[model samples]
Target chain A: MKQKRMQGNADLQKLTDLAQQLRRDTIRMIHHAGSGHIGGALGLADYMAALYGWAMQYDDLDPTDPDRDRIVLSNGHTCAVWYAALARSGLIPLEELATHRRMGSRLQGHPARKAMPEYIETSSGPLGQGFPVANGIALSLRKRVSQGRVYVILGDGELQEGQVWEAFMTSAHYKLDTICAFINYNNIQIDGKVEDIMGIAPLADKIKAFGWHVVEIDGHDTASIVAALSEAASTKGKPTAIIGNTIMAKGVPSMEGDAKWHGNTPNDAETEAALEAVGTNNRFKDFPIANRA
Target chain B: MYSGNKAMRDAFGDALADIGAQDDRIVVLTADLTDAIKVGKFKERFPERFYQMGIKESDMIGTAAGMAIDGQIPFTSTFAVFTTSLANQAIRVNVAYNNANVKIATSHGGVCVGADGATHQAFEDVALMRLIPNMTILVPCDANEAYKATIAAAKMDGPVYLRFGRIPSPVVTGADDPFEIGKARILRDGKDVAIVAMGAMVPAALEAASILAADGIKAKIVDMHTIKPLDENTIIESAKECGCVVTAEEHTVLGGLGGAVAEVLAKNLPTPLRMVGVLDTFGESGEPQEILEKYHLTYSDIVKQVRLVLKQK
Candidate 1:
């Protein structure tokens, strides 16, 4: 029991470090691109870190294997986090991270499966669309009789689209328990705070009403995120919705919880400051030189 | 080559169920129009493979695209308008952009879905689907051809829009007739003029050919079913042989089959063309035949367009 607890703690620490690196990568990618949805990407780093670093099982050599678990970024605008996770996890070449959002880059502004076919499961930038694709993936996986599960992340504002509800119903109606979706509740969208824009109040009830096994968690807590994913995989007969309450632009102290950072790239000074705040990893030293912060 | 008059939707259901039995990967998704889309047969046969997705076209499309991406050949069905226009976002991004091997087989593709009103009638489905890249648009001529097209779509990769008619139509293609994707079939040979038609309009074009034959005018009948990745070689060859072309469909004259044919001719052949379709208008609730005639989408309309194009030639 002691040894297992120690291993769990070690894994949590690694994931925490991973979350910091991912946040730094998110900032660097957006800063280099000169424009991107920074807030959501930063906010989603912890979940992405937890998922890529620990939960997801993929063949590093053959990433598109049929048995590999699918990671559907439904909130595609925050692809910087997804791209960073893929690179950091060694699933993709770390050098390719520089080409993010650049013209002709496989790392498209939105998660386009056609652009990065093996990595991205589907093209999803339109809010409320990715979850449905994830549901479909889960459904297909069931039909394929594979152990693969679909991990999807949706923006809180995305729930406003009626299509999300429709897809939510589908996951339950078909009893596609293989889908473990996370609602990146950063409380902000392109417009403003999610609640101010369109109230998705009583979110747990709404998702439960839609027939999901709801697991509310602190988005930044790697342990909680990992636990929820496992809980989702274990729970049968219905899909799980892990509502991760996160701070917008997490790990970047100056921009945390600020809706204004939702779509803005960090300036040179802001980038340096943000990099320091997130504690950049030595693995991606080429991205931002040492002592730059 | 006429087998009998049967609704194209019913034929699509039969072909879908038959295909489902052959391939375990084949799945069918419906948006509460199970019987109307004729996918009830599919649901009955492949109960596990069939998904009654409720009245959610957008979700249905996205889910279908997902399944396709994961190596399942998913055939999503609904009224043409719902999938084409209402759930167009999913079609554009998930199916087209992702290039997922999804088949959007729909019923009531044209304004001929009488009594369903303008909302259900999809006059612009072909045009909407054609605009998207990586989409293979197939408007099968009749019930028999619809079955063949469904099977063909299953064999092909990437996004396919298999548009079918709601009303019963004469079977023009025989069992032995070739039904390859992106290949147009020449129903009748002619030299004076050509009639390139798709969906419900193919039967009308065949009738027009016989009518023109009586008047000593040999109008070639071409069933240009696959609208996208269109059979340009066939269209140009036919236009070159006949000197002029008349494109017909149960859709608007603006940008459906007519527009696709016109674009091809202008770029390659630059042939004189006349389009016989709904003239930039919405359909009203009425008898399918009556509405088609009023919108100039029948045999007589094809004859009228052929004469106009022949004059230009």
Candidate 2:
């Protein structure tokens, strides 16, 4: 029992380290590209780490395997985290992370499936659109009798879009248990705080009322995310909604809880500080300067 | 209720049921309009595959795209207005951008929706659908064509918008007639004028052709159903043969069938042309036939337009 506990703790530590690496890579990619949603990307790093590194079952060699688990970034502005996660997981080349938001690059401002259809299931930029697509994928998986699950990452502000609620009702009504949604509850949107823009208070209660099994956890905690994902997998007869309580800019010290970093990229000095604060030694020591153009 | 007359929506339901039996991957989704959209047959046949989306057109569109991504052929059914206009953004990003294999089967297209008013009638579905990059727009002329188009849409990969009408119009094409995407069917052969039409206006154009024939005018009728990949070859051929063209449809003259044909003619043939359709106005609540006549979408309108074009020629 003690050995088992230690093994679990070691696994948690590995995930935590991976989450920090993802945060570092995400910050560097945004800073190098000169534009991206840094705040949400940073906030969603731990969840991405848990999903790609530990929880989700996907083939690193053949990412487009029909029975592989699918991860859909519904709030596609935080594509930095997705790209970073994909790269870190070896699903995509780590060196290609430099081309984020660049001209003729596969990594666009949003998660465009045209860029990489094999890994990215759908192109998503508009809010609340991804959730329904995830529902459809889950429904299809169910129809095929495939055990594959679909995980959709959405923003807290995206809950304001009526289509998300519609998806919520449909998934639950269809008894799509294979769908597990994670809301990055960072409380900050592009304009301002999510509450100031449009309050989706009583969010967990509302999702539960809609017939989903709801789980609220600390978004920065790797262990809690893994546990919640496991609970979601075990959950039968209904979909799961994990309300991840996360800070806006989670890992970076100066940017944490700051709404201004929601879209703005950090400069050289700020990037150096953020890299140090994220505590990952995998900093870009020889990143190509010519690729910036 | 009458012989050789059935609503395109009913044909869509029957066709879906037939196709669903053969293809297990085929799924039906409706925004709480199963009976109205006539997908009840498919629902009864494949209860598990049929999804009642409960009036949420946007969600339905995204969900259908997702299903498509998972290698399932999802046919989303709803009123034309809600499917095209209400779910425009979702269809653009989720379905069209991703090139997901989603069949948007929209019933009650154009002023044929009648007393449902301007809000319900979709006067600009073809225009809206055509604007999307990877979207295939099919405005079937009658029930037989609608059935064929639905089946073809299922067989074809990527996004397709199949537009049908609420009224029980004439079944112009028989089951044996050839039906292919982006191919125009020339129903009548003539030399004086070419009557190019789509959707509910095909029957009107055919009737107008007969009326012109009685008046010693040879008017050719072409059923240009697929609007996006506009059959420029057939339109140009008809123009070369006829010397003049009159385009007709139940949609607005601004950007529907008439606009598509005029675009092809203006660039390639530059033939004298007259358009017979709604003159950029919303339809009001009335009977289908009453509104169609009020909007000048009847055979008489097509005849008038044909005569005008022939005079210009």
Candidate 3:
């Protein structure tokens, strides 16, 4: 039993390194572009890295390989993390990460289906649309004889759209066992704090009420996220909603938990500091700093 | 009795059931209007594939996109006016953006909706959907055509807008007529003038053809159902053969079937053409036939337009 526990710990440690690499990649990609959503991107970095590295099953060589798992970014504004994870996972070239949000570059400000390969799924800039699209993909996969899962990520702010609730209701009703929703509950949006701007409190309870099986976890904790995702996969007869409790700006000291950092880019000096804080070697050197509204 | 006005909606449900049984991937979605769109039969048969989106068009579209991603061909049903306006973004973003294989089954299109006024009447649906990239716009002429179009859209590879009318016109086309998207079918050939029509106006155009023939004016009638791809070849050929044209439809004069035909003619042949449709007006509550007459959408209207365009030449 101890041996099994140690093996699990070692596996989680590898995921922790993957998360740090994803963070570094996100910061580098956004900093190079001179623009991109940084707050939510940084917050969701750990969760995304964990999913791509371990939770989700996909073939980088053939993205549209019929048997491959699907990951859709519903809150596409936070695409920095997604692009970084994709590159780090060998889905795209690691060197191409620097071209993010640059004109003539495959990477766009938001997740664009035209910009990237077929793996990007669909163009998702306007909020509240991706969730339903993701639901449709999930439902379709469930209909096929082959088993494939669809993972969708959304920001807490994007939840304000009534469409999310509508999708949630339909997902539960259909009992789409193959669909899993990840909510970056980072408590921030473009205007201000999510609570002050649009009180979507009791979000978890609301999802539960809509008949989805809810799983709450730490967004920055790679182990907790992976564990929660596993629990969601094991959940049968209904769709799963994993609410990832996260800090808005996550790593950098000045921007941590600040709503102003949502779309704001850091100065060169600040970027250096942020990179140093996450660690220079691209492995998690410090635990997540817990700060709440 | 649901009235003759509700036959298209009823046909939509019947065809969905007929098609759904043969294809397992055929899923149905509604924005709280399954019964209104007359999708109850399919829903009852395949409860597993039926989804009630509860009046949210945008979300319903997004969910349909998701379903499409998973390899299910989703048919989202709703009133044409509501779907076109409320769910425009969904169609653009979800279906068009990814080029997802989703069918937008829209009923109660145009002034034939009657009694519900302009709000229920869908005049600009064709125009709006036509603007989207990779979208196949299909306006079926009747119940028989609607069923054939539904099946054809299911087999097609991308996003399709299957526009159906509220009232049941004559079943002009044979039950076995194979409906093809982006291709115009010639109903009757003539040597003097060509009448290009779509949706509920095809029967009117056919009647106008007979009236013109009696008056020593040989008329050609073409069902230009797939308006987006506009059947440029057929329109150009018809223009070359007939010399004058009359385009008719149950939509707005702006960017509907007539506009599509005019664009093809203006750029290709520049032949004298007259349009027969709603001219910058909103519809009002009345019976379907009363509204059709009030909008000048009858055999007599087509004949008048044909003579006027003939005089212009």
Candidate 4:
């Protein structure tokens, strides 16, 4: 028991360091692109870092390994952060991280399978559609392969789409224990507060009613996210839904929970502050030294 | 020609059960249409693999796509109209986008849905499915053909839409007959005109050919089942052998087998063609036999179209 706890703590620390690096990558990439969703990316940084760096079992050498567990970004707008995490995880080169939103860049406005194998399982942009696609992946894995997990992340605001519930019901009906669905409950969408824009209150009860094993956690805490995802995987005979409580603009003090920061590019000064907050200056070391820009 | 013995929907279910026994990864999902689409057999044999989505077509397709992603061959069953109209987004996103291994098993296709009328009859099903990219469209002629098509659909890697009619029209093809995707079979050979048909209309075209053969007109007949990746070689060859062509189906004239054949003919040989199908119309609630005659989807209608096209020659 003592040894297991020690190993868990060590994994969390490595994830935390990677999370900080991912944050730095996220800030610099969005700043360079001049157009990208920053708030959700920052908010999801810790949760994504935990999945790629610690939780999900994937191979850096082969993306389409038949036995590898699949992680799908249902809310694909936050590809900026996901790209950074993938780069840090060695799934892609760290230099390519800054090429986000650039013409001919593998990283695009949305997560596309063409960008990098294992980085993106499906191309997603339209809201409320990825949930079912992820479920399909899980169902396939459950039926064909012996042991594989499917993790999908959804924005809280996107839950209002009826298709999410439809997929949720089906997941539970089939008792898809191999799939884990995460909702980044940032409480803020592109327009305004999610409650104000569209009331998604009692979200936990709603998912529980659909027969999913529900877990509530702090989205910014790496350990909490990891534990929740691990627990979801361990639980048998039911699908898992983790309702992550997150601040939309989590890292930067000035931008926390600000709806305006959801999709806007930070200015030079703001970018500097954002980079400093994450405690990284690797942004300036560019061109051949770090050709990702 | 044998008729009124078995519905294609029943054959779909029986074949699915047999396929499930062979391939454990094959799962059968339906929108609360287990009995309606005859998937009860699959449910009885492989209870664990069968799922009923409870009248939600969108969710049914969405979940089936999910199953496909894991390398499972999923057959999502529902009425042709609902799957085509209500669940098109799921089909386009979940199945077509990633090219998931999903088969859309649709029953009650075209005006053969009889007493259920326009609401149930799926005249535009072929049109809707054909418009989507990377979708294999198969219209099985009878129970035997539906059985063969069901097995073929499971073996396909990408998205597929297998259409089956409600009425038991004809069991023209033997159960052991060979069936291959994207290939058209010549049922009868003639020189005056060529009749290209699918679904319940294939046998009608054969009957029309016999009548024309007696008149010494000799109309050629081809079963063009796979509509999307149409057998252009067979269609063009038939058009070359016979200067005129007539395309028949139990669907709307706009975009069914008729439209597919016409599209091929227009681009390839520019043959003079007449289409025998629902003429830009919706079917009404009546007996199955009455609906076929009323909508002009009969052996007589096919013969008339054959004569009309030959006149253009």
Candidate 5:
């Protein structure tokens, strides 16, 4: 039991290091782009890092392989984190992270499947769409009898769209067991706190009532995310929803839990502070830093 | 109710089932309109391939797009109003934006849905779909054409919107008639005025042509089945010969077949044109014929439009 606990600690440490690296890369990407959702991206660093690091069965060389586990970014504004995950995982060239949201850049403001057809499971920016697409992928996977799972990320506020509930009902009704929804239960959206804007609280109960095997975890904790993902994969007879309770801009202390960082990129001083806080991911050393000195 | 004359949705559903038999990749999704959209045949034949998406049209579109991206040819069937109005953004982003192989096979287009009322009818479906890039819009003439179009849509790829009517008009086209995605079919030969029609309006255009023939006007009748990627070659050729053009449809004159044909004529030939359709008004809950006549979408209305365009020429 001691040895197993140590092994788990080491695993958590590795995931923790990777999450910091991803947050660092995401901060630089947004700082370079001059505009991106920094808060959600930072908040999702842990989820994305754990997903691409050890949880998902992905091959960067065979990115287009249909059998690979799919990541459908339903709430696409946080693509900075997804791009970081991809780049840091060696799925994409780390050097290209600087080209985010630029003219003719593949790393679009929103996740465009056509831009990176091989890696992007589905293109989505509009709220409440990626869930159904994920369900579709799971449906197709079920038909093919392939050992592939679809991991879809959702924002708490995106649940307001009536289509999300429809999608929730669809995955449950169809018994698409291969789908796992990771809900970014950050209270902040564009306007303000999610509850103040429109409460999607009692979110776990809502998803559970929709027939999903629901689990709540600290969305910023890599170990909890991995554990939740494992629990979701093992749960049978229905789809699963991991309600990840998270703070906005989780990595950077000054920005954490702040809604202002949602679409606001960090300035020069803030970039230095953010980089200092979440150091650099050794894998992405070649990635350029854009600080307006 | 008549032999060889079934609703366009029924014909489309039958064709889809047949296509599903031949091609294993064909899957059908309905937003709780199994009987209404007449996709019951496909659902019955391939229960595994069919998905009952409850009453969620938006979710159905996204799901179809999801399946399509995975190399499955998914056909989303529902009433035109729900599919276009409620889920138009879903179609725009998931299918059109992603260029996914999703066939949006919609029924109950226009005011032809009998007593289903204005809320259930659609006059802006074609317009809504046409605005999206990489979208292929097909407005088939009759049941026969709808069947042919549905089969073609399955065989073809990318984002496709095939608008089908709710009423059972005559089976005007042959079963084995040639059908392609963006190609227009010429039904009658004439040089007086080209009557470009789509969906239920084709039969009216044919009758209108016959009426014009009695008065020494050799009107050309065309089944402008494929609205988007409008067959400019055929329209221009017919316009040059006919000197004037009468575009007819059961939809609004704003953007259906009329808008497509007029855009073509206005750009290339500058032919005298008159659009015969609902004049930007909501349809009422009445008999299909009463509503059609009220909206000036009947054969007589086509005749008047034809004469009106001829006078312009």
Candidate 6:
């Protein structure tokens, strides 16, 4: 019994390590691209790691597997981490991450299904729209009796959009328990702080009022994220909302909790420091940067 | 005058119910207009597949797109004004951009919405929907055509915008009349002039053609139902046969049937054309007939436009 517990801990540690590497990759991709959302991507790395590494039942070989789990990134601007996770998991080639945001690159600034339909479920850029779509996917999976869960990640600032509230009502009203939504509560928007721009504070009560199974946790903690996802999966009769408390730029000293890095890309020095901070050796050694303006 | 003819919305509802019976993947969604949009029959028949999306049109559209992505054919219905104008972005991005198999069935199209006023009436739905890529716009001529269009939209693989009216108009097209997307149906053929129309104006165009026939002016009547992927061939053929053309519809002359026909004629045929539709104005609280007449959308309007076009020719 003790051995089994230790093994589980070791697996979680591996996931954490994978998340650190993804964080470094995200920084490198954005730095090379010269433009990308850095903060949210870094903030969402651990959640993506937890989902792709442990929770999701996805086959990189058979991407269109009927029983594979569906992951929708509602905050599509933060697609760097998702791309990194997909690349690391062998769903997409790691070298392709270098061509991010370049013309004809599958790794677009936003998650576009047109670019890569096999892995990206839907083309998403406009905020607060993906959650409702995720609800529809969940409902569809239920109708098909596929037993596949739908997971959606939304940014805290995106909650200000009215459509998100409408989706929240829909998920609960239909009792779409198959949908597990994680809100990256980084408390920062493009312009400034999410609280100052338009506060969605008392978010827990608001979501509970919408009849969702609400769970708040430290988003960066692999163990907590894994546990919350497990709890969400077991939850029935209503959709689960995991409010993942996160920093805007996690694992990097200069940009952590900073709003300026929300959409700003890292320069050469900043990229090197971010990689060092993430503790990833041989940063992007295998991935060759695509020559594009 | 109200014939024993059913409203296009009623036919749409009936057709959806019939289609849903055959294809279990056919799901119905409404923005609190299940009864208003006449989708109640679908709701009654398939309670499990029917989703009441409340008063949120935007959410309904996005949800339908999601459902479409997951391989379910979602037919969402609501007021034309709300669906097109209010939820235009959702339809553009989610349904059209992604090429999701979402059938947007909008009732209460044009100024025929009567006492509901301009806020409810959708005179620019076709124009708005036409601008989106991968969007097929169907403005059915009569109840039968609407029914056929609804069934056809179900079979279609991409995004489709099916527009119907609130008031009960004449059932000019019979069950035998062929209804196909991107194909115009010639109701009457003549050499003097071509009266190209769609939706409620189709019956009006036929009436105008008969009036012109008596006056020694032969007018060809064409039901250009499918607005986008428009039958440019038919329009050009009709223009070549007849020296002049008059486009009519229960929508704005700016970008509806009139605009579509004009586009075809200008680029390819380059014939004399006059448009019979609302002249860039909103409708007020009045009866359906009163509003249509006020906006010059009557048979007499078609007749007048035909004469004016002939004079131009």
Question: Tens digit of lDDT per residue, candidate 1, span B205-309?
Answer: 899889889999998889988898898899999989988989888898788888988888889989888888888888889888778777777899788878787
Candidate 4 lDDT by residue in tens digits, B154-234: 987889999998766668888667899999888777888988999988888888888888888888888888997888999
lDDT of 6 at A27: 89
Clashes of 4: 5
Question: What does the lDDT come to for candidate 6?
Answer: 0.88
TM-scores of the models, in the given order?
Answer: 0.96, 0.96, 0.90, 0.89, 0.96, 0.96
Distance from true location, Cα of A123 in model 4, Å: 3.7
lDDT (0-100) at residue A165 of candidate 4? 87
Better of 1 and 4 by DockQ: 1
Q: Candidate 4: list runs displaced more than 4 Å.
A: A1-7, A10-13, A30-35, A61-67, A98-108, A113-119, A140-147, A230-237, A253-256, A264-277, A281-293, B1-4
Ranking by DockQ: 2, 1, 5, 6, 3, 4
What class would a CAPRI assessor give candidate 1's docking?
A: high
Candidate 6: tens digits of C-alpha lDDT, residues B1-313: 1135679998998999999999999999999988889999999999999999999999999999989998999999999999999899889878998899999999999887799788888888899998899999999988999999999999989999999988888898888778889999999989999989989999989999988899999888999989989999999999999989999988888878888888888899799999988889887999998987888999999898887888888
Candidate 1 B-chain TM-score: 0.97
lDDT tens digits, residue span A177-237, model 2: 9899999998898888888998999899999999999999998898899889888988999
**How well does candidate 3 score on lDDT at residue A253?**
71
Report fnat for all candidates as fractions from 0 to 1: 0.88, 0.93, 0.90, 0.66, 0.73, 0.66
Error of model 2, residue B257, in angstroms: 0.7
Collision pairs in model 1: none
Candidate 3 docks at the CAPRI level of: medium
lDDT of 1 by residue, A186-224 (tens): 788778888899899899999999889999999999888
Which pairs of residues have clashing backbones in candidate 3?
A132-B62, A132-B63, A133-B62, A133-B66, A136-B66, A136-B67, A137-B66, A137-B67, A137-B70, B115-B286
lDDT of 5 by residue, B108-182 (tens): 898977797889889888988888999999988888788888888888878899898888887788877888877
RMSD of each: 2.9, 2.9, 5.2, 3.6, 3.1, 3.0
Question: Candidate 6, residues A1-293: lDDT per residue as tens digits?
Answer: 00111113326877887888888889889998899999999999999988777788777667787777888899999999999999888788888989899899999889887788777888888998788888888888888998888899899999999999999999999999989999999999988999999999999999999999999999999889988988898898999999999998899989998889998878888888888888854433435666634
What is the Cα-based lDDT of residue B118 in candidate 3?
A: 81
> Of the pair 1 and 3, which is ahead by TM-score?
1
Question: What would the TM-score be for candidate 4 when compared with the true structure?
Answer: 0.89
